[model samples]
Target: MRAGLATLVLLALAGYVFLHYQTGGARAPECVVTGTGTGEPYRLQPQQAANAATIQAVASSRGLPERAVTIALATAMQESSLRNIDYGDRDSLGLFQQRPSMGWGSEEEIMDPVYAAGQFYDHLVQIPGYTTMPLTEAAQMVQRSAFPDEYAKHEPQAAMLTAALTGRAAASLYCTSAMDPAPGDPGEIRGRLAHEFGDAVRTDHSGRDITVEVPEPELSPQGWEVAHWAVAHAAEFGVERIVHRDRVWEARRSVKGWQAAREQDTADGLLITVAP
Candidate 1:
């Protein structure tokens, strides 16, 4: 069997074991999702967290419901452990393990998380009553995986992840970043935001920071959406601090999560301070 297929088998089994028994070796810079009124925080690796956030952003951009995000996350967790892998059961690739043979997309396109997620949603919406259907049922209708039932086990974890990444869980998602920082490219940051959020979000460059704006009414949830996405992509974008409402996440600090900004909110959008 191909290495990708072998890896998929091992990861799928490991995910099942980890979720079921809560046993796994520790990983550094873990992504913790909490405050969803659940039993405990759901943990993931940083890359998994990034992928999950991207999935949530893409779904939100398309005006899809939270149910769609839940279904997508659960499917991704089951298929690839939420990592954008280049290998899978057979010609499968990316977060959702979509296959070229199955007419999902070109290999290059499928590997792109934004494109892969869009495709997933496209197929999902066609399934009538999918929002009301059980997650496993909805996912199976789209994925048609050999092990159709496995998606069920991941829903609880996925739901928690969605809550935080979607900005519905307030400041529950957190991560640590390198103390040292470098100047970031505004163009690249804008490109990444547009790629993930489509046109729903706008970015402005000022010195070393980028101000991200969503439609007005800039409620806590929407503000947190931009803030958490900044945190999730902190390493990639050289983010130093993110301020939304009265809370802030500073990379050089020990909080490793959101904390009081110690100042009042004078703006309507998220202020992402990057290294200069």
Candidate 2:
């Protein structure tokens, strides 16, 4: 077998071990992010990946740089492990653990990942030179956490996530299809895309397949942004396959991560096929 195929075989086996390998009964949906040359992969529960996607989408909608994304991710990873949890120390809640008592937002608003991420950016941008400061310092200025340096520990992983989610690094993320008994709903995916990425995201649906046209106006982070987003939510949304540029990932074969797509799939935009 060729080198790439060999890599795929190993990765598929890895996926089997982590994704489908038995542990008591069954496994929850999961996503793995690599491609930072770290030689180590970062794993996320479906919910964590979904929350990170929201955070990245929020930053992109505001035209923030990758640095901002990295900072926000690290903060979220440190705060609540990227889950929109309902509780935290004291009154802290949501991904950033923003306390409603401290004026971040109402308890309901803060628990919404999109709202919470937006609130975090609203404060992040106000910092005079947040982009230039050290990651921990920038995060500290926004979140008055007791241990500021803790954010630094997650910076590397956060940076890796940023690269893949931002479209800077292609084909770096994939997930085992979530085993929802219901067939995937194209409309649901469309609405969620709009909610997190805004109505500006161009998309189309033909049955269970959703095609997202690359944001022609801005290619910098458009295509892969949606590509990774689709994959990260695959397990949660029942997405069976995703194709972008020259790569493809299938729910049934997710362990291979992103394999080289066939010649015919070499289109500009990407395609997402949901469970039937």
Candidate 3:
């Protein structure tokens, strides 16, 4: 009887393993976060990854340091899990949960991720020595949340996200997305780029391919910022591939993340190819 029971247990375990592999259980889409030099990575969903990227972009465009990005991200993670939502604690809405009643912005403006981020930074810089202040204290100065200490726990994850989004974690940001063949709209891409990076991003389209140029030389961080942003929004924008520096990310095999690329005339600026 004992021998028979053991055999049944073994069979059940085997069946479960087989079923797990057959269903793509462990292979589901996810976002990966790694440290700049060396540290364990953190994993989260694609939407969170997009929100992180947007927060970083808005901060960088304002010429804020990576420290500012870390604080903003930590605050958002604690407030809304990095999501731009329409609901929050009474009168609060969007990431960072800024209350419209407190003069952060109109409900419609706060809902815009870029504008919300800008508002957060605008207040953050006003705090004397916010750059050197403790993460929790700095965040509290702006939020005045009932539970101020909650922001501390999120700082490590926020730092990791800042590293990846700001290009310090080189080749570290990627999102798993469904395969879609439709081409992205060049007009929309140009507009979004302008909104984030300002009018400095020179955009021109040739057929389905959209080219964005940051004419200044040796702007690796700035270039990578744009490249990673394209990757984060690839599925939404139908980006086929992104080439910057010596690495390339292609939609067909984006699961592998950034990879070494073939030599090309990338001297003028980073190149992004959109799908048709």
For model 1 the local lDDT of residue 131 reads 94
- Highest lDDT among the candidates is held by which one? 2
Q: Estimate each model's TM-score.
A: 0.86, 0.86, 0.86
Mark the 10 consecutive residues where model 2 has the least summed lDDT: 19-28
Off by over 4 Å in 2: 1-28, 178-181, 215-220
Backbone clash pairs for candidate 2 read: 178-235
Task: Indicate the TM-score of model 1.
Answer: 0.86
Worst 10 residues of 3 by lDDT: 21-30
The per-model lDDT (C-alpha) reads 0.82, 0.85, 0.81
Q: 132-196 in candidate 3: lDDT tens per residue?
A: 99999999999999998999999988988887788776677876554553677777877888887
Backbone collision tally, model 3: 0
Give model 2's clash tally. 1
- What local lDDT score does residue 88 receive in model 2, on the 0 to 100 scale? 91
In terms of TM-score, how similar is model 3 to the real structure? 0.86
